[model samples]
Target: MQQFAGNSCSRQEMDELMQYVREAENDQLLHSALQQQWSSLQPEEPLYPVNWEGMYDTIVASPATENKVGLSPSPIPLIRRRWWAVAAILLVAAGGIWVWTKTPQQKTPPVIAAAKDIQPGSSGAVLTLADGSKVVLDSAANGNIATQANASITKRDGVISYGGKAPGVAANAPVGQPLMNTLTTPRGRQYKLVLPDGTTAWLNAASSIEYPVSFTGKERNVSVTGEVYFEVAAKSNAPFVVTTPQQQVTVLGTSFNMNAYTNESIARTTLLQGSVLVKIRNSQLKQSSYILEPGQQATGNAGGMLQVRDVHAEQFIAWTKGYFLFDHASVPDVMRQLERWYDIEVSYAGAVPQREFGGKLERNLPLSAVLKMLETSKVHCKVEGRHLTVLP
Candidate 1:
């Protein structure tokens, strides 16, 4: 039996044989071969045999065997042929580890060959006015654009801002025709804009913001689809409000971040300064509200349930500061952020093992480098042009 176990019985072949042994009926020839392999296993010290009684109990209780294999056979005489057969099978199964490691292993295929070339976020956006005019705001743009009512729209130092007062309009002007302004950044892009109402906003890559030309009436409101960092202007009389499909965040004056991307079901509102009230949509007449203090975050789901927790404000707002800081984040969450920034596709061949990764990666690093860092944790990744696939 030992002579028959030649080079032809590769690790792969042995694995298949062991799997077959688990399900197939026991025979004398197969049983003798397994016993020969098991007898060869010798530890440096006297190794006690495994507690098969306890192992058998666990196997019997397992859900997979509950409906199929049923309970273990009644304990038989120690010298019976059936008892020896079961012991040999268990011993052979335990020796599989030694065989696999002792044999030559196959070479794995390479995944990402080179790292992607990406730069730090910069000043970039595509602005569209109510008059159907498009303006690309970046470092190259010379000066301020046309003034709107009481504010002078200006671009300086790679940022867009509004100054001066409405020339002839009343202190409280009506919310004129809805004017849409969108701020977007590519993989290596970042931007900052000061709204007409003195509200300053910073945008991360692949993000956008839409707002009216001016705020009129009792409340100041804006709608966002992606991520944005807001340092809202203080106005006790006019509260600032941010609205998304899942919920709304209202504040008197505060600095916070709203991550309500369409692809993510959970809308997160992380407060950096002051306070804000998060209102979640529910079936009841009164929506659930959560008040957040500085260094707190309110995560609201589409189902209208909400949770408030403490978080590091700087880490939550790291994207606005030109970096992707992860503290034990999941692979899927990390990949989701990468997908939006790089504008690429991602898929997985098998289950992504649950791993907690902690590191601070510059946003400017190439996509390939990011994937390489992930591989350090035993996770493999393959990059085919713009598509990235994760494999176990």
Candidate 2:
């Protein structure tokens, strides 16, 4: 018998073992495997280092009726059900422990053995060069990728930086006929960039930023497609402008965040430092433009007035800091962030329930770990392959 405990296995080996667990109707085989795995990983020893006792106490006795493996049995003595429940719990815990420690190789398609249906995103993106060539930034060698005329674009320490004189920096020479370069983060990936003007941009998953290799004209301008947090370089003569689908934001030597996902109703611009002018073009905005102060957020587009409200700045830019900050965020809102981060899709079987979440969760946790947290809130769900279905 292959022992998964303390022994690593390839994805295919894990698949065979998991299939055995799922299909084995023989109680003897199941008991042998369960006992062997359990003896190796002492459940009584504690799952977490410091909080083992707390977790142990939390694992209350499951009702006899709770047969997690879909076992059919007649109404028997109370003692049998209680013991069955304990066995089921130990089997599950041991299996999860084994699966948690194993990871598939990079090129192989990963499978979720026990709990996590999806894994967290990492630093990756696609860099489209000026000459219509595409470079997979995640796999590319980290160094000087390609030079664009006078400026050089280099990848170092997981960030792409632009070096060399821009339109009005260092040498006063004209940076003629600027070539455009765009950095895009596909679903389940993210990246950072330092523009030619020394401004830094952190792009969220499913987001992109396109700009000239060199700062041009009186005002440095760039266009964005999704969410991006920016630390604009201070250029009094050449202000920085970020143009999105529904609105445009103008800033000078400041930091801010813009969330303009096409599926979202409102396009929001939150200012964390300095000042910014948000111009809304949607019909929802009665007033077209408003100046945002630090710690203020401008919400509403064409159909509404540029409404400015106070917000926790960190919550808006938490993704840049490697965390999901959910302060009374709705379930749909939470799932949308998860969808992009894990590169999965979510759907509801019926009318979506109204749910709000408030807390800070690490983005690095496996999908199962995160979902287990959600179960406490009564958000029952299941992940089949890459799709997550919300249960009533």
Among these predictions, the greatest TM-score belongs to: 2
Q: What is the C-alpha RMSD of each candidate to the true structure, in Å?
A: 15.9, 14.4
Q: Number of backbone collisions per candidate, in order? A: 5, 12
lDDT of each: 0.63, 0.71
- If scored against the real structure, what TM-score would every candidate get? 0.65, 0.69
Question: Runs in model 1 with CA error above 4 Å?
Answer: 1-121, 146-151, 167-180, 186-188, 282-287
Q: List where candidate 2 sits over 4 angstroms from the true fold.
A: 1-116, 166-177, 282-286, 302-304
Candidate 2 lDDT by residue in tens digits, 1-392? 24344234554564465455444364567677666756665645432232333222222221221232223433434534433443444534434311122222233332232444578999999989777898899998989988776788899989999888744233333445567889999999999999998999999999999999888788899999889999998989998999998788998899999998887878889999999999986654347798999999988755556778988787798899897866556778888999999999999866564555554567887788777655534455778888997765
Relative to the true structure, candidate 1 reaches a TM of 0.65
Predicted structure with the largest lDDT when compared to the true one:
2
lDDT of 2 at 81: 43
**Model 2: lDDT of residue 153:** 86
